[model samples]
Target chain A: MGTIVSILVLVLFLTAILTGGYNKKFLQRVQGSNMWDWLTTVDHKKIGIMYLGAGGFFFLIGGLEALLIRVQLFYPNNDFIVGDTFNQLLTMHGTTMIFFVAMPLLIGFMNVAVPLQIGARDVAFPFLNALSFWLFLGGGIMLNLGWLFGGAADAGWTSYVPIASNQFSPGPGVDYYVLGLQISGIGTLIGGINFLVTIINMRAPGMTFLRLPLFTWTTFVTSALILFAFPPLTVGLLLIMFDRIFGSHFFDAAMGGNSLIWQHLFWIFGHPEVYIVILPAFGIISEVISTFSKKRLFGYNSMVFATILIGFLGFMVWAHHMFTVGMGPVANAIFAVATMSIAVPTGIKIFNWLFTMWGGRLQFTTAMKFAVGFIPTFVMGGVTGVMLASPPADYQYHDSYFVVAHFHYVLIGGTVFGVLAGVYYWWPRMFGHKLNERLGNVHFWLFFIGFHLTFLIQHWLGLYGMPRRVFTYQAADGLTWINQVSTVGAVMMGVATLVFLYNVVYSRKSATAASAERDPWDGRTLEWAIPCPTPEYNFAQLPKVRGLDAWWMEKMAGNKELEPAEPLQPIHMPSSSYRPILMSLGFFVSGLGFIFRTIEVGVLGLVMVFLLMFTRSFEQDHGYHIEVDQIKEAEKGA
Target chain B: MKANAEQTKNQTAVQTSQESAWKHVTSFAVMIVLTAIAFAAVATNLVPSHLLVPLLLTLAAVQVVVQLYTFMHLNQKGSGFPVAFMASGIFIGVISAVALMILV
Candidate 1:
C-alpha cells in the first residue's frame, strides 16, 4: 500500500509539471496552477499562506494522533494501541503539535501581518523568509516520515536522556527527532533574526518603536525570545545526536557523563519556548480585543513593558521544570520564585485587555469571541501554572494529568484560540475575502467548550493520583468516566476543526471583489491602509505612521487613505527563486541520511547544499521594479 | 591665511581622519602589549594560579571592547541598535552561563 501510494504521488507530481510544461492553455485557465511560481516566490504574503497551509496540514495529523490517544484512554485496560504504539502516538502528538503546528501557525500570522503593520514593502530578507518557511515544512515532513520507517519517536517530546539513549531504546526514532528538530530549529532561529532586523530597521519614516501596533510589539518580543531560546535546544539536540550516533556519551552515566545536564539544557530552551508561542498569542488577543471593542489598546506602553518582562523572566524560570530532579532546595526556590513572578506581567496584560474592552462597543465577531474567550481560559491556565510553580506543590503535580491539563489550557485555550482568532481576523486581509462569520462562531463555540470540557476534568484526575503518559489504567482506579468525557470533548474539537475547514472552502467559493473591502472591520493598523488582497508591492508609497493607530488617526482626520511618506516611484520587489526549497530539500535528505546512518547519502546531500550556497554567494539578484505607471493603474483598479 | 569654507571643512575632515588613525594604532599597540603580558604571566607564573584565570579573563574582556570600538567601528554613529542588541545578547548569555556555573 505504501509503495502504491508513493508511485501514485510521483505520477501526480509528474503530471502537474508535464501538463504545465507542454500545455500553455492549462496553465492560463486555472488560477494558482502555475505551481512553479508558488514554488519559487519570495513574496512574504505567499510564504505566509504556505506556512498556514503546511501548518494546518500538520495540525490535522497531530490532532488525529491526539484523537487516537484519547480513544485508547477512553476505556480502562483497552487493548487498542497498547504500549509502544501508544507511546509513539503520544510522543508524535506532543512534538508535532508544539514544534510543527503551534510554532508554524504563529509564525504564519507574524509573516502575514508584521511587514504590513510596520508599513514596509516586505520583510528585511525576503529570500530568507521563504527559506525559513520551506525549512520548517521540510523538517515537519521528516518528523512525520518516522512512522513510515518502522516506528515513530516514542521517547516522549522531552526525549529524556538514558531512556532515549541508543543502548536503551535502540532505533532510528530518536535520531529522526534529533535531526528534524535541529533543521527546523535553525529555520526558526534565522526567522527570528529576520524579524528582528525587519522590525528594527524597516519601519516607515516617522513610525517610531513606541508607535508600533500591539501585534507588532508582541512579534518583536517573541522574536527576541526565539533568538535567545533556540540555541540551547540546538546544542542539546547536537549533543544527543553525538551520543546516539557517534559513540559519544554526553548523557551516559556509565561513562561519567551526567544525565541531569540534559534536563537542564532542555528546560532552559523549553521554558522560554512556552513564552515564544504564547507571547504572539497575547499579541493576537490584544489586536482582536482592541479592534473589535473599537478602542485603542489601553495601557499600550505597560503592555509592551509587560511583554518584555515576561520574555526576560521566561529564561530565568527553566529550572522550575527540573525541581523534581532535585537540584537542591535553594536552586528550586530560586526557580520557583522566578516562575511565579512571571504572573505579575501576565496579570498586567490580562487586566490591560479587560480595560481595553471596558465601556466600548464590543462587537462579537468570530475573532472577537475567540479573543474574549481566551482571557478567562488563559487565566485558568495561568492560575494552575502558579499552583504548579511552587516547588513543594510541583512534587505532587509533576508528570500528572494536572500538568497536562494546565498546558492544554494554555496551549490550546491560549495559543490555539489566538491562532483561530488571527485566522478569522486576517482571513479577509490575507485572501481578499472573509470567512463565513456564522460558521466561524460555530467553530469558536464548539472549540471553546470542547477545550474546557476536555481538560477541566483532567485536573481532578491528576488530583486523584493519575500519573500521565500511561497507556492504560485499571477500572478499580475509578477514572473511567472522566477519561470518557475527555474523549467526547476531543471528538467535539475534531468536529469543530472540520467545521473550520468547511468554512474555509465555503468562503472561498462565494468570495467576490465587493466583499474584499480595503478597510474591513474598520481596522486601525497600517495593514488595513493597503488593499484587502494586499498589493504585490504592499504599499505603492509607504504609509507615514504619524501616531499610534495610524489608520484610525487618518480615518478620524477624514482621509480616505494614508498620508504617503514618499513620492510616487518605482517599487523594487525581490525576485522569486527556486533555491530556498532546493536548499531545504538538500537538508531534508541529509537529515534522513544521518538518521539511517548512510555516509554516502549524507555526503551527497551536504554537497548539494554547499553547491547551492556557493552559487548564492556569487549570484546577484537585484530584483525587478514595478514602475509608477503600473502602480497607478493597479491603484485605479483597486 | 583666509581659507574658503570648503577648504576649512576638508581640513577638519583630514584632522579627524588622522586622529582616528592614531587611535586605531594606539589601540592595536595596547592589544599587542596586553597579549604579551598574558603570555609572560602564563609562562613565568608571575601571578598565582588561583588569580591567573581571572586576570586572563579580564584582559580578554578589555581586548574585546577595544577591538569592537576601534576595529569594528562600534563607537561610530548609527551603531546604537547593533550595540543594544549585542549588549542584550551578551547580558542573556552571561546570565545563563553564570547560572549554569552556579547550579550545574
Candidate 2:
C-alpha cells in the first residue's frame, strides 16, 4: 500500500511536470520556454541534441573518474584513494565510457543524420526513438544511483560471476549493474531495430542499396549487430539478475554451476560490442575523408563488403578473450587466426582512406585533421591488437598495462577521434552556429598529443610488468617516473577538453556571428542541400536520388537543387506524445524497486507500463497534419 | 500510376495474403503432427532411448524450418535480411555453446 501511494504520487508529479512544468502551458510552451516540449518531443533533431547533451555529460563524469584513478596512481605507494573506492571508480569509468559515452554519442549522430541523409522525414518509429533515448537516460541514472544508496558496482564492468555472486558482493551495487544494463540493453536493441527499418524502408525514391551513404550503410550493419549482439548480453544479465535477486545458482560453482558460463556469455556480446561502436566510427571516417578530399570514396564496394565481413568476424573471435582460461590449444589457435583475420578488412579501410585522399584537393579543416590523425593512431592500436591476439604473447601481456594501452589506443584513437570529427563536421547542422574553428584546431592538436603521450608509455610499463587495475605501486618497483608521465599526459588531455567546452560556450554567445549553417562546408550529401537549422519537416518534397553523391551530382549539373520528385501535399506525422516518458519512468521505478527488494514497487511499475500500453491502444491518434500552406510558408522562410 | 498496374498490384497483394494464410494453416498442422510423433516415440517406448534422442533432434530441426518458412514467412519477399541475421545469430550461438561444452 505504501508503494502504491508513492507510485501514484510519482505519476501525478510526472504528469504535472510533463503537462505543466514550464511557465506556460505545455501547448503554449511549444513556442515559449518549453522544457516540457523537450520532454515529450518526438522530433528527431531535438532527441538527437538531448542524446549529445546527456552523452557529453556522462563523458565528463567518466573523465573525472579517470582523473581520480590517475591521481591515485601518480605517485608510488600513494594513499590518495583506498581499494574499495578505487574499485568503484575503475568499474564506473569502464561502464560509463563504454555504455554512456561512446554508444549514445554515435546513436545521437544516427538519429540526426540518418533520416536526413536518406531524405526521410523521421525515423520509421518516431515514438519508439524517443523511448529509446529516455530508457537509456533512465538506465544510466540507475547505474549511478548506487553511489547514493550503498555502493557502485565493483566487480568490474564485465561483472564476472562467483566474485559477482550475491553472497560474495552482498550489496545492491551489482544488483544495480544487472538491472541497469538490462533496462538500457532493451532500449539499445529497440533503437537498432528502428534504425534497420528506417534505413530499409525510408530511403528516397532513387536511393538504392548501392547508393546509400557510408554512414547509412554502417548504421544498417551496426543495427544488425546490435540485434544479434545484445541478446547474449540480455541473457547474461538475466542469469545474473536471477542469481542476485531470486537466489539462482547459475554461477555458483559449489551448486554444480560454472562461473565460466558468465565469461562466455559476456565476451559473446562484448567482442561484437567493440565492433558495434567502431563500425559507426568507420562510417564517420569514410564520410569526413571523402568530403574533405573533394572526391568520392575510393573502393566503395570493397568498403561495404568489408564492413559486413567485420560484423560477421566479430562473432567468430569472442573466444579469443578467453584463451587464458584453459580453452585448449585447438580452440585457442582457431580463435587466434580468426582474430588476426579482422585486420584484413580493417587494412582495406585504411588503404581506402589513403587512396581517397591521394590526389584530391584536400581541405585540412579541423574535422579532416582529426580524421587524418586517427589513421596512424588507430593503425598502431591494430598492430598491438594482433600482438595481443597471439596466446603465447598474450600470456605475458594479460592483466598488464599493455592490454589497457591497446584498447585505449583503439577506443580513444578510433571512437573518440571519430566522434570529435563528426561533431566538428556536423556542429553547424546540429546547432545554428558553427563552433569556432581556431579553438577546435587547438583542441584537436592538444588532445592528439596528450592521448598519445598518456597511453603510448603504458605499453612500456606493461612490458616492465606493471599490472592493470592496481591502486598504487611500491616505490621499490621502479615504476614511478613512467606512471607520473602518464598522469601528466592525462592532465593535458583534460585541459584540452576544457578548451573544447569553452569553445562551445563562447560560440553559443555569438550565435548570429555568421550564417554558415547552409552548406557551409560545400558538402556532398542530401543533408547539405537543406538550409542549416533544418525545418521540422526535413524535405518539402521527396528527393529523387539520381545516383551516389546525389546532391553533388545536382550541384555539378548547375541545377541549384535537384528537381522535386512530387508536388507538395499535407504531411501526415505522428503525434507528439508523452507516453514514452511515462513508459520509461515505469521501467526506472521498477529498477528502483528491484534494488530495494520491494515487490510492490516493482509490480506498480509493471502496472504503469501496461496501463500506458492499454491507453495507447484504444486512443485515436490520427496525427496532426501540417497544411500545405504552412509548408509553403516554411519553405519561403528557408 | 497506371490503372492496370495499380490493379495488378492490389490483386497480387490480396493473393499474397491469402497464400500466407494457407501456408500458415498447413504449417501448423504439420507442426502438430511432428510434435505428436516425438511425444509418442517417447511415451510408447518403441525405440531405444539412445536412438530416440537423435530422432527427436532431427524432427525438431525440421519443425523449426517449417515454422520459420511457413509461419514466420521467411520465404516471403523482403525477408532476406532478417533471415540472414537470425541464421548467423543461431550459428554463433551454436558455436559458442558447442565450444563451451567441449573445451571448457
Candidate 3:
C-alpha cells in the first residue's frame, strides 16, 4: 500500500512537471530546475500550502485506517484484522490524526492567515518557518517508515510506559514513535517560538493587541501554548528513546525507574496539545461566524480572555485523564473542578457566536455552515466531557467506547469542522479561488451527519459496556447493530472526503473568474486588503489597522484600499536556502539509523546535520529587495 | 549640520558609555558582595541547616535577576517582550514544579 501510494505521488509529480503549464514556466525562471524554486522557497504562503498538502495526505491515510477499523468492527466475531495489527492501525490512526493531520492543518492555516491578518509581509523568520515544515515532513516520513519495516507503533498513541518498555513489546515500533515525535516536536517548538516573535514584533502600525483579528489573536495564544507544551513531550520522548536505544532505565520498572514519570511528562504536554489545536480552530470559527453573520464578534474581549483562560486551564486538568490512578480525593477534586471550569469559558464562546448571529444578515456559506454546525456538535461533546471529568463517573466511562465517542465528538466535531470551515473560508485568500459552494455544502452535510451517526450511538454502546481498544466483540455482546451503523457512517464520510477532493480540483480549473475578487466574503480582516493571488511581498505597503475588523472599518469609511502604514518602498525579502531541507533529511536519516540500531550510520547523519549548522552560523546571505516598481507592476496586473 | 549631528551623537555615546561603565562596576560590586554574603552564611552557619537551602536559593535567585538586568541588559529600552516571556516562563516553571511536587 505504501509503495502504491508513493508511486502515485511520484506519477502525479511527474505529470505536473511534464504538463508544461504555469508551474513549469515558473520553474524555468529558476535555472530550469522543476523542484528548485519551490524546494528552496521560504515564502510562508508556499510553506503553508505545503503543510496543507502534506496534512491532507496524512489525513487520508488516517482516514483509511479509521475505515479499516470500522470495517473490522462492522460485525461481531470479525477477524478482519485481529490483535497486534489492529493495535498498530489504531495507534497510527490516533498519532497521525493528532500530530500529522490536525495540528499541521491548523499550523498551515496559521502560516497562511496569521501574518496576513496582522498585516505583515512575512513571518518573523521565514527560513525557520520553512525549516519547521521540513522537519515536520521528515518526522512524518520517519514515523510511517516503521510500517514498511515489518511493524508500526502498537502500544497506542499515548504509549504507556510499562507496555511500551523493551520487556513487554520489544521492537523497533516504539523506537520509531519516540524518534519520530522527538524530531517533529522540535520543529513544532521552533515554529511556536517563531510565531510568538512574529506576532509580538511584526504587527503593522496601529495594529494593537486588541485591534488584532480573532484568528491572529488565537494564533498568538496557540503559539504560546505550543512553546510551553512541546518541551515536556520532547523530554518524554527522549527518556523513552534512552531506555530503548541506549539501554537505560528511565521508564523500565525493573530498574527502579518510576513508570508514572512518563505518564506525568506525556500528559503535561498532551493536555495543552488539545488546546493548541483547538484554539486555532476556535479562531477560525470566530472569523467565519462573524464574517458570515455580518457583525462584529459579540463580547470580543471576553472571547479573547476565554481563549487564554482555556489555554491556561488546559494545563491544570491533565490529571483528569489519570483520575482513576488513585491521585486521592484532593487532587482528583481539584483537577475535576479545573476541567469543569473550562466549560464556563467554552460556554461563553458558544453564546458569543450565537449572539453574533443574532439580528444580523446570516450568509449560509459553506464555511458558515460548518461554523454554525460546530456549535451544537461541540456543545454535546463538551457536555459529555464535563460528565467524564467527575472521577467516579470517569471510572465507569474510562477506556470505553463512550470515552472514544466523547473525544471524537470534540476533536472531529470541533477541530476537524473548524479546519474545514477555515479551508473553505481562506481558500480564496490562500489559493486565489473560492471552492464551489454546492459541492462544499454537500461535503459539509455528509461529513456532519456521518460523524454524528458514527459516534453518537457509540456513547450508548459504552453505556452497554462496550470496551474500547479491543478488535472484536462476541455476538452475545450485543454490539452488532450499532457497529454496523458506525461502519455505514464511516463510509459516508469517506465519500464526503472524495467529494471535497473533487471540489478542490473542480474549483481550481474554474478559478480565473473568482480569483479576481480580493474580498471574496467581503472579509473583515486585514488579509482581505491584499489582492488575490497575493504577491510575494504580501502587501505593497503595510496596512495601518485603525480598529477591530480593520478592513471592514475602512470599507465602512468608503475607502477602496487600506490606509498605508508606511510609504511605498522597496521590500526586503529573504532569499531561499537549501539548508533547511538538507538538515531535516539528515535528521530523517539519523532516525532510520537509530531505529535499525546502525550506530555508524546514525553518527554519519549527525555529522552531516552539525556540519550544516556550523556553515549556517557563518553564512551571511543578505536577501535581495523587491523594487517598488515591481510592486507597482504586480498591483497593476492584479 | 552633519558635523554638528555627529558631534552630538559621539558626545551622547561617550556619556552613555561612562554612565553604563559606572552601572556595570556598581552591579559587579553588588554581585560580589552577594556572593561573599552567601559564602559567609554557609561558612559561619548564619542560618539553621533546615533553612539554609532556601536562603541560598533565594540569594541565588536575586543574583540571577541582577545578572539579567545589569549584564544581559534586560533593563534596556524595548526589552519588554523578552522580559515578559522570561518572567512568564519562570512563573510557569515554578507553578509546574509545585504542581508536580504535590500531585505526582
Which candidate has the top score in DockQ?
2
Please tell me which model should have the higher lDDT, number 1 or number 3: 1
Q: Who wins the lDDT comparison?
A: 1
Q: What's the count of clashing pairs in each model shown? A: 0, 0, 0
Q: TM-scores for all candidates?
A: 0.94, 0.95, 0.94
The docking category that best describes candidate 1 is: acceptable
Clashing pairs in 1: none
- What do the candidate models score in CA lDDT, each in turn? 0.90, 0.89, 0.89
Model 2: pairs clashing at backbone N, Cα or C within 3 Å: none
What are the per-residue Cα lDDT tens digits for candidate 1 across A61-103? 9999999999999999999989988989999999999999999
Q: Is candidate 2 or candidate 3 better by DockQ?
A: 2
| 1 versus 3: better DockQ goes to | 1
TM-score of candidate 1's A chain against the true A chain: 0.96
lDDT of 3: 0.89
> TM-score of the second chain in each model?
0.78, 0.82, 0.82
- Tell me the tens digit of each residue's lDDT in model 2 across A399-464: 899999999999999999999999999899988778888999999999999999899999999999
In model 3, the runs with Cα more than 4 Å from the true position are A1-31, A513-515, B25-46
What's the distance in Å from true for residue A158, model 2?
A: 1.1
Flag regions of model 2 displaced more than 4 Å.
A1-33, B1-25, B44-51
